[model samples]
Target: MKLTVTSSLLALALISSSADIGVHANTPFIIEKSPVDITLFVMSRCPDAIKCESTFSQVFQAEGLPEINPTLSYIGSIDETETSKTELDLSTTSTTTTTTVVTKVNCKHGPLECAGNTHQLCFREFFPDYKVWVPFVTTMNSWQPRRIGESAYAREVAERVLGLRQRRVRRFLSLEEEDAEEKKKELEVLLEKVDECSEGQRGFELLVKSVQNTLDHGVGTSCTVFIDNKKRCVVDGGVWRECPGGSTVADFVRSIKEAAGKVFRISW
Candidate 1:
């Protein structure tokens, strides 16, 4: 598929109202720290990607003021194939409880007649013990698809669907951990900034921008902040704002914090 790529600049503004209070280089806003060793893959053209990016940017811009440990490094241009492969591997292996059966049958009758034959005179089973194994195989096969699908969905939900929010929460928590006082102050400032940026903006345009910006620079696919080992998020551009069930950046962020808190024991 042809991907439409767009570029927008994220100005990490460290604006000071007065000259007496000079913005210090070591004050943390301007210095770009390595993000939390995470990698994110996103298409520049995708809406969900954009949403994820903006959320992280907002979070970083908000939390990255006074410096914090677990720096979030934002890498550019993810290899889609590699990301997909990694995701697939993670999905396939992260599952539990899989069963498979091997069956061996001996018959003197023709292969076509085996199905029609009901009497034991035409066929004999070499491994009578195999019958006991049949249930195990059947159970395994029955649950295999569910296990695989759940793992895949889990990864998708964690990485692609809920990634931006997770990264934001993680970064926020990291900031809190590194310096609670600093994080609190920065969060206040960030919230003010968000209020200002969102002022006079309303409705769908605001929603789109929120999602788009998040993906482009903040939390999702196109984010600059890295969280774990892989990109903490993914953008399903095809589904972005295409339905009412689609969530806003704020909503997603809230949900992410809640979910991550449950899973990773990190509070936002």
Candidate 2:
């Protein structure tokens, strides 16, 4: 018989199927090896989002934590009614074709916010590892409101965090210039990928997909966290709110550990 896993009922069903009720001391133990899945929904320029991510940054910084894989999603709306199009025509052949293009996406915080969202999506795409991308995002969020979508600001932040600027400054003074140059090249390549992604149509597509996921999940809040496919917490005004399961770093750590689930087998 096949069983569908949901809540604690799966545990009950497993226990009832065991043949050796109390005869065996060593029973087959099952343990979940999968990492916890966490999804964060946020608007790039929202203060609430900043606070929420800052809290999560602390969670990540905690020592001796379980494996937690977090994904970032954006929240916004797209206006399909308002669009721009490109027309391609061959005058001699009397053939014409038109293609509709997405000019802009409407964000609650306005165009700069939209741009910020796109850049973040691009960053996540290129740097999927939470360790690499999370701090970069947190730094961006900590920046002033005026710098939210500025490419210059983003470039400078990337340089500072990735140590590209320091590498450049040391290239002239260091004894091992070749090593420094190689390191600079690697960082520069990744930064170039981010720039290309954020400035192209692919960035818009990623932003739209992220927004759609937020809409599909019916998440209207600026900062909402989902763990193991369930709503875990919300942070607004720099405080935890709407967290039924508790809202401390320890609370989140406990949830993540429990979310690993359990597995066992009958020993007859």
Top-TM-score candidate index: 2
Q: Write the per-residue lDDT of candidate 2 for residues 1-268, one digit (tens) a residue.
A: 2445464687887787675445454755554466778888998898888888888888887777777788888888866753445454656655555556544468998888888888888888887888878888888877555698887777777776666766653554363767777766777898998999888888988988999899899998889999887899998777788898898877887777778663223324
Query: Model 2 residue 152 lDDT?
Result: 76
Off by over 4 Å in 2: 1-32, 82-104, 168-177, 262-268
User: Against the true structure, whose lDDT is highest?
Assistant: 2
Cα deviation of 148, candidate 1, in Å: 37
Worst 10 residues of 1 by lDDT: 118-127
User: Relative to the unseen true structure, what is the Cα RMSD of model 2?
Assistant: 8.4
Local error of candidate 2 at residue 9 (angstroms): 24
lDDT of 1: 0.31
Model 1 lDDT tens row, 150-251: 223222222222123244544635545447555545544543443333232331233333334334654533333233332333445434432232345454
TM-score of the candidate numbered 1? Answer: 0.20
Per-candidate clashes come to 37, 1
Q: Give the C-alpha miss distance for residue 215 in model 1, angstroms.
A: 20
TM-score of each: 0.20, 0.75
- How displaced is residue 34 in candidate 2, in Å? 1.9
